[model samples]
Target: MNFDDLRTGSAVHQFPGVLLGHNVRIFHPHLVNLYGCAIGDDSRIGTFVEVQKGAVIGARCKVSSHSFICEGVHIDDEVFIGHGVMFTNDARPRATNDDGSPQSEADWKVELTRVKRRASIGSNATVVCGVTIGEGALVGAGAVVTRDVPDFSIVAGVPARVIGDTRQPVSKAELTA
Candidate 1:
């Protein structure tokens, strides 16, 4: 189904539900388990990006191919989610909830996942739930992020830490297209 038809705003647009925002662009074959989802303008959800319910992607964001933005993740503007990056919002997960029904909002402890503006998460990175990746933070490739990433910090490794400051001047290689 085309999301352009049912796009509505405010954080939680559901599956078979509305997905509204300014200039929202979703690549084809995107599998979204929709519920409570909102995306700001000029945002690109690349192929294979599954945006679960309650996932808010802000303006000018690029969610790369094969990435998973799970429920309750709030991604700010100009963020780059590299290919295969995964964001999980639930600390505890169960296959099924009580009453023998599949898990819903009530089943898991849903914590807020916020990725601030201009932060770049490298390819194949995993962002665990309830952690705030601060503005302009850089998470290296294949990193498993558990703790919070401070603003302008560069982190690499399992359970990411402050390895360096990314606020320095950009080199020619970094600056060049």
Candidate 2:
């Protein structure tokens, strides 16, 4: 729902610094800091889901508990972010900025995290920003995604590589969702 309509409640608990659009429903135990982020209606950001500033989350998406949507992230509609999934914008982040000053908004490189429609990032997966996860692709849990994932393919590993296709889940790559 709209930002003004957001009130402090137990079921739909929201913290400060969060910026939500109209008709959006946050499920129980969901906590988000409003910081000028845009989220469309009918999207479900579950418990422990954190959407940072400058993030644009589309409508009708399911962001599972413990998921991290960092700054500059852009997620399209009807997508899924499983539990504990994280998106990183900085390729080589330092403790401070190049000038040796404490990290601040000015220090941010402003990288982009783009998740196309219908793509699903599995639990505990880490997606490196500046890379696009193709439509309908699946990122397996515990995977470290460092490259562009193809459409409808499945990837899992330290440097996540396409190992199978989610279109045929019951086949060789019968991994858990």
Candidate 3:
């Protein structure tokens, strides 16, 4: 669908400031909240997804439904973000400051999170801020990532630990005879 067609009623909100590259498909556009973000060409954003301001999604990425891509999050090309994935941009989050005042943008710094090229984050994963999920890494389902995942590694569980490596070639001996 054309980007102009996305400009519909109040139910769907795709701000004019959002920079969408060629052939970017937002499935169920009326169910998504995207603003001030840059989605590269051939990317598909699923329903119930909210891509916040300053978030950059690279080419050929698939962001599944019920996912939240907060500010300062950069998803590289060919990344697959599974359903119900949550990305945090703050190492410490508080609604109010010590002075008993409501916290504003200036109150805290946004920590950047990067999901490198070809990384696949599984469903219900919680990716903490200031972590770089290295290239071709596989984050297992329900993992809570708190640190940098090495390249071509597979991580699972809370505070995600490296369980395997993706670059390892499958041996015939390990398979059925």
Q: Which number leads on TM-score?
A: 3
TM-score, cand. 2 vs. native: 0.81
The TM-score obtained by model 1 is 0.78
lDDT of 3 by residue, 1-177 (tens): 233432222322445568787777888887889988888778899999999999988889999999999999999989999999999998989999999999999988899999999999999999999999999999988999999999999888887988778888644343221
Q: What is the model-wide C-alpha lDDT for candidate 3?
A: 0.87
Please write out the lDDT profile of model 2 over residues 31-86, one tens digit for every residue: 54445566766777787677777787886788888888889889987899999999
Candidates 1 and 3, the one with greater TM-score: 3
Give the CA lDDT, 0 to 100, for residue 9 in model 2: 33
The most accurate candidate by lDDT is 3
Where does the lowest 10-residue lDDT sum fall in candidate 1?
A: 6-15
Better of 1 and 3 by lDDT: 3
The digit string of per-residue lDDT tens for model 1 on 1-177 reads: 133543554433324554666666666633534456777777777877788777888878898888888888999889999999998877878888767889876668988999999999999999999999999999988889998999998888776766777877545443221
Can you give the lDDT of residue 118 in candidate 3?
97
Candidate lDDT values, in order: 0.79, 0.77, 0.87
